[model samples]
Target chain A: MRAVVWIAEGSWQACVDQARAILPPDTAVTLLHVAPGDVEALAEGARRGLFGRHPPPPPPHGSIREISDAEAGRLLATARERLGRECETMARRGRVEREVIAACAQADADVLVLARDGERKLGPPSLGHHPRFVVDHAPCTVVLAWAQAPPAVETIPPPPRHRP
Target chain B: MSEVVALLALALALAASVARVRFAPDWAVAVAGALVLLAVGAIGLTGVGHALTRFGPTVGFLAALLVLGDGCRRAGLFDALASVMASFSHGSARRLLAIVFAVAAATTAVLSLDATVVLLTPIVFATASRLQLGSRAPMYACTHLANTASLLLPVSNLTNLLAFQAARLPFARFAALMALPWLTGLAIEWLVLRLAFRAELDVAAPQDAQADADAERRPLPRFALALLALTLAGFVASSTLGVAPVWVAVIAAAAITIGVRPRPAELVAAAQPAFLAFVLALAVIVAAAGAHGLSSAVDALLPHGDGLLALLAVAGVAAALANLANNLPATLIILPLVSASGPGPVLAMLVGVNIGPNLTYVGSLATLLWRRIVHAHDETVDIAEFTRLGALTVLPALVACTAAVWLATQVT
Candidate 1:
C-alpha cells in the first residue's frame, strides 16, 4: 500500500499511530507539508505598513519564505520520525488544500492522512475548511485525525486561578 | 463611447486589483486602470495633475511614516516589545490575550494602523507559536485592534488624516475630540473578541518559552525604545509648533537611519513602491469615478445637517460605502461632500470608515494586508468565521464611537 500523509502545524500523532498500526511493513509513504503562497502578500502588506506611498524594494535576507522553509522542514522531519523508514518527504509551496490534493496525485497514493483542524481545537470533531477541501477533492481514501485530547481529569493537575 | 469604455476599464481594474487570481501585482492593475483612463481621454493630463496635487501630501506622509516604522522594526523594537508582552503572560493564555490587546491598541494609536499590522502581526504570531498557543486569538487581535484602536488621533489612520485636514482641526483638538470615541471603540472590540475567543483563551500554553528564546536571540534594545519615545515627542512638538507632521517624521527617520545605519536594501523594502502605486492609482480611479458619476451619487446620498442625528446618518452611510468600496476610496469619494457637513459629520464619517472596515476582508487595505500576514504564517481564518467575529464587534464599535463623536461635537 502507498500512503500520502499531510503534516500541518499541529499534533497529528493519532494519524501517525494509526498509519503505523495499519500499514503493512513494506508500505511506501510520502509525507507532504504545504507552506502557504502568501509570502508576497505579506511582503506587500509589510511594505504598505512601513511605507505608505513608497515602492517596496527587493526583500532582505531572512524572508518569511526562508523561515517557512525551515518550519516546513522541521514539520516534515517530525512526521518522518513518526512514520519511520517507509516515508519520503516533500515541502511544496501553495494553498494548503490544492497542494495536498496535488501531492496525493503525484504520489499516486491509496490513502491520505491529515489533521481535521491542524491547530485550534475547540472540543469538537470539526475540520478546518482546508482539510475539508482536501477530503472533498482528493482522489484517495482520506483519514482525518482529531487533535490529541487533553489528559483525563484524574491525571490532570488541579486548576489554579492564575499562573505562578 | 469613450465613457462606456472607461467605465468598463474601471470595473475591470477594480476587480483585477483585488481578485484572488493574480495576473499581475495589485499596483500594476491600478496603474493600468489609471493609464486606461488617460488613454480614453476620460481624464485629461490637467485633471490627473490636479488629483495628484490634492492627494500627494497624504501619500508622502504615509511613506515617511513607513520609513520611520521600518527603521523601528529593523532595530528589533517590535520584537523586543512582543517579548516583553509575552513574558507577562507567564503561562496564562487569558493574560497573554490581554497583553496582546493592550499592545495592539497602543501601537495602533501611536504609530498608525499599518504600523501595527506590519510590525506587530508577525511578532505576535511567533510569540503564540513559541508558547504553544494557537495563533487564532493573537492573530485576530492584531487585525481587529489595527482598525478599532486607530481612531485616537488624525495620524492613527489615513482616513482620519484626510478628515482632519478637510475639517481643518488642529492636531491637539483632533486628538481631544477623538479620545472618547477611540476608548469606546477599543472597549467594545475587546469585549467582543474576548467573548468570541473564550474557549481558545482557556487553553494552557507553555508560558515564558518565547521570552527565553527571544532574549537569547535578540535582547531588548533600549536604544530602540529611546528612539521611539523621541520620535513620538517630535510628533507632539511639531503639532504644537505648527510644522507639517511629515517633516517631523522625516527628520526622526533620518536621525534613526544615521544612528542605526540599516542597509539600503532594508530601507527600500520598507518603502514598498508597489503599494505607493496602488495608492496613486486608486486616487486617480476615484477621481475618474467622481468625474463620471460616483460623486453626484454620493452627493445625493450625503446627509445634510449639523444635528447629532444627521451626523449619525452620515456615519451610517459612510460605513456602508466603506465596506463596499474600501475605506480609502470611500473617504476620497465622501470627503468633498462631508466637508460641507461640519466637523461633526466629517469626524463621524471618519469613525465609520475607521471602525467599519472590521466587517469584511476587503473593507480596507489594512484588513486585506492582515489577512495576507495571517495566511503567510500558515494559519487559516475562514471567511465566514472572520465575518461572524467582525459583525459581532464592528457594529457596536461604530455605534459607540459615532455617538461619542456626536457628544464631542456638542461639547466643542
Candidate 2:
C-alpha cells in the first residue's frame, strides 16, 4: 500500500515545494537527487579521451555543496517547509528516473509521483517511454503522475501533458 | 506472303530461344539473334499488306496500359493501400499474407497483374524491412497472388480477355467463374504460407521501434492517377461496347501521349514488361494462326456441350505451360488453341494459370518483380525458401480450384 513521491531534478526548492503540496498528512516521502559525479557514460571515454572535439565546455561552477543534515536534506527542508510537520522525509540518491522506477518496484509502491517544473518535462529520462515497456514487462501497473501546469504561463492554473 | 513470313519468323524465334537455352549469347541474345531475326524476317518476308500502321493491337494495347496505370498512380489512389496493409497483418505469416494478398487483389482489380506486382513489390519489401518481419512469406505470397489475381479481371490480364472473347460468354457468367478461383487460391495461399513458415512465427519484431518507409517514390505513383482512371474506364467500356481488348490499349496510350511532355519512356515503363510480353504474345499468336492450323482446329474444338472436360484440360495445360515457359507467350499460343476448346473451359484455365505460378519463383512476371524489389532493399530471400513457403499454400489452393473447375463444368 506504499505510495512513493519522487522529487525529480530541478530547483530543489521549487520541486520540494510541489511535492509537499501533493502528499497527504503522515505520508512517508523519499527525497531523491542525482549525486554529482563524472559519470563518464563511455568507460572508453574515461579510459581514453573518446572525443577529438576539445573537452565539453566545462560543467558550470557554483556552490553545489550540501545544505543540511543529509546532503539531500536541503531539498527535504524545502519540502517540509511547504508541507508542514505531517510527512516524514528521507533522502536517497541515484539516477532520477531509473532510481525512481527501481525504488518503486522495491517499495511495492502503488504509484511513482514525481514533481516537474512544468518545463523540465521532456519526461523522466527513460521511464516515460517505459510505461508501454512496463505494460509489456512489469508485473504490476505503473502510475505516472506529473505536474501538468505548463511552466511558461506563470499563473500555475490549468494542466496539460505537454505545452501544446 | 505476309502470313508465310509471319509463320516462318515465329518458328525461327522458337528455335532461337532453344539455342539460347543450349548455347546462349550470339545466337540467343543478339537483337539480330534468333528471336528478333525471325520476327524481323516474318515482317520483311511478306510485310503488312495495305497496313498504314504496323503496330495495331500492339500499339493500342501499350497506349491503353500506360494511360490507365499512369493516371491512377498520379492520383495517390494506391498510396494509402500500403499503410492499410501494414495495419492488417497481425503477425509474421498474416502480415506477409496480407502483403501478398494486397498486391494480388490490387493487381486483379486495377492495373495489369504484372504492373500491379511491380507497383506494390517495393512497398512490400519496404514494409517487411521496416517492420523487420522475417520469413520469406511476403515475397512468395506477393508473387503467387500477383500471378493468381491476374486471372480475375479481363482488363487486368490478357489471358482473361482472350478467353472471354473466345468463349463469347456474358459479363455476369465470366464474373461468376472468376469469384471461386480468386477466393480459393487466396485461402490456399494463406494456409500454405502459414504452414511453411510456422517455424518462423516467433521471429522477433524490430527493436528500433520506429515507423519505417522503404522505397516510396513520388510524382511517379502520384501523377499517374489520370492514366489509371482512363485505363479502367477503357476496361468498363470494353465490357459494354464489345470492342476488342486492343482497342482499350490504343485509347489508353493515346490519352497519355497527346501533346504532353510525357516522361521519356515513362508510359512504356509503366505499361510494364509483363504487359508488353502479353502484347508480344498476341502478335506471335496472330502470326502463327495461318501456318499452325490454329484457326480451323481451334474452331472445331470450341463451343462444345459434350467436350467441356477436354476444353478445360486444354486451357489448363496451356496456362501451366504459359507459367513455365513465359506466361504471356503461352497465353497467346493457347488463346487460339482454346477458341476450339470453347470459352468456358478456356477462361477457367486462364484463371488457373493466373494463380498457379504461386508455386515457383519464376512462375509469373509479377513474382520476379516482387523478388527484385525485396532484393533491391538489400534484403535476402532465396528461391528455395520462397518455394518452401509457397508449397505450403499453392498446392492446396490449386487442388481446391481444380475441383471447383470440375464442379463448374458439371453445373454448366
Candidate 3:
C-alpha cells in the first residue's frame, strides 16, 4: 500500500508515529513537508520596495531563500529520523494545504496521514484552516492524528440556553 | 456636483485599494483613479503637469534615498550593524531590546523608516531567534521605532519630506525643531513597549554558540557606512550650499550606485517607478480635490494659530484622518491646509502622522509592510494585540510630541 505522511513543523512527530503504527511494514511511505513561501515573498518584497528594480548584493551569510531551504531540510531530516524507516522525503513550497493535497495525489497514495496543527480544542477549529481544507479535499483515506492527547469533554463549552 | 461626487468616489476607491484590496498594486489603483478624475474633467491636463512639476523634487528625493538604502543593504551594512548589536547584548534580552531601539532609531533617522522596516526588521528577527530571546519584543521595537524614530529628520519619512518642503524650513532648522519631539516620542514608545512586552523581554537570553560564532564572522561594510554618514552630512550642508536636498540625495545615490556597480536592472528596481508613479498620481488627485471644494472643507475644520491647544487640535485631527485613510494621503491633504499656519502646526501634523500609524495596520504603509515581514517569519501580531499596544503608546507619544513642538516654537 502507498501512503503519504504530511509533515509539518510542530506536529510532524505525531503524524510519523501514527503512520508507523498503522501502516504495514512493507508500505511505500513518502514524507511530505510544505514550506510556506512567505520567507521568499518577504525577501522579494523588501527587494522591490526598498531597492530600486535591481537585485541587492548577496547577504553576508546567505540569501533568505537559501536559509529557508536549509531550515526546511533540517525539519524534514528530523521527521525522517523519527519515522525510523526508509521513505521518500519531499519538500515543496507555497500554500500549505494545496501542496499537501497535491503531494498525496502525485504519490497515488491509498492513505494520507497528518496531525492537527491548530488549537488543541474540542471543535472544528482543532483542525485549523489548512488541515480542515485538506481533510475535505484529499482523494484517499485520511487518518487524522492529534499532536497531543485530545482535550477532555469538559473543555467543550455548554450549549447556549434560549430564554423561555 | 458630478465632479465632487466623482472625486469622492475616487477617494473611497483609493482608500479601499490601499487598505483592503489586493488584486492590483496601490500604484495601479491610484493611477486609475487619477485617470478617472482627468476623464471627468475634474482636473485638466495642466493640473497633472503642475503636480508632476511641484512634486518632482520630492519624488526624486524619495527615489534617491531608496537607492542609497538599497546600496547599504546590499553591502551588508544593516546586517553587520544588527550582528554587532546582538553581540553587545551579551545574552541579555533586555539589553538586546535596548540595543535594537538605539540601532533602529539611528537607522530610521538616517536611512528612512522604509529602510528600518524592509532591511533591519528581518535581521532583527533572525538575531533574536538565534539568541533564543524570543523575537516578539525586539521585532516590535524595530517596527515601532521605524515610525516614531522617523520624526527626527526630513529624510526620515516621506511625510516629513512633504512637510519640510511645504514649510521651507532650512534642513538644520527643521532638525533642530524636531529633535525634542523626536526624542520625546521615542522615549515614550520605548517605555510603553518594554512594559507591554515585559514577558518576552524578562527572559534570559541563552547563549547560542553558533549564533555567537556567526555574529563574529560577518564583516562590517565600512564603505557603505561611510557613504551613509556622508549623505546625512550632505543633507545638512545642502541648505547652506544653496541647493535643494533632492540634489544632495541624487548625487549621493549616484555615488553609491557607482560604488556598488549593480546591474542596470537592479538599479531600475531600486528606483521603484511604481511607487514614484503612485506618489505623483496621488498628488494629482489630491491637487484636483483641493481645487474642487475639498480644500475649503478641510480648511474649515483645521485649527488656526500656533498655540499649544491649536497644535494639539491639528495633530489630533491629523491622527484621526491618518487612521481613516492612509498616512501618505493624509499628509497630502493636510499639508496644504496647515502650511499657512506656520512651522509649529506643520511639524505638529508631522508628529501625528508619523507616530499615529502605530495605532492600526492600515494607518501607514510601513506598518502594513512590517506586518507582512512579521508574518513571513512565522509570527503573528493580531489586530487586537496591535491596537492594544498602539493605544498604550500613540496617545502619550502624540500629546508629548505635540507639546514638545509647541514648546520649541515658543522658545525660538
TM-score of predicted chain B versus true chain B for each candidate: 0.89, 0.69, 0.92
Q: Which candidate leads the pack in lDDT?
A: 3
Which digits, one per residue and each the tens of the lDDT, describe model 1 over residues B207-226?
24445644645567777677
Q: How accurately is candidate 2 docked according to DockQ? A: 0.01
- TM-score for each candidate, following the candidate numbering: 0.73, 0.53, 0.72
Q: How much is the lDDT of residue B201 in candidate 2?
A: 40
Candidate 1 TM-score to native: 0.73
Instruction: Please report how far candidate 3 places residue B245 from its true position, in Å.
Output: 1.3
Off-target runs (Cα >4 Å) in candidate 3 are: A1-164, B5-9, B12-16, B19-23, B210-216, B362-381
The share of true interface contacts that also appear in candidate 2 amounts to: 0.00
Residue lDDT tens for model 3, B247-290: 88898899889888879998888877877888888898899888
Q: Which of candidates 1 and 3 reaches a greater lDDT?
A: 3
Off by over 4 Å in 2: A1-164, B1-55, B74-79, B89-96, B165-173, B202-238, B241-261, B268-282, B289-308, B364-382, B388-396, B406-412
TM-score of chain A in every predicted structure: 0.76, 0.46, 0.87
Candidate 3 iRMS, in Å?
Answer: 7.8
Ranking by lDDT: 3, 1, 2
Model 1 DockQ reads 0.12
Which 10 successive residues of model 2 chain B have the least lDDT summed? B25-34
> Clashes in candidate 1: how many?
7
Error of 3 at B246 (Å): 1.1
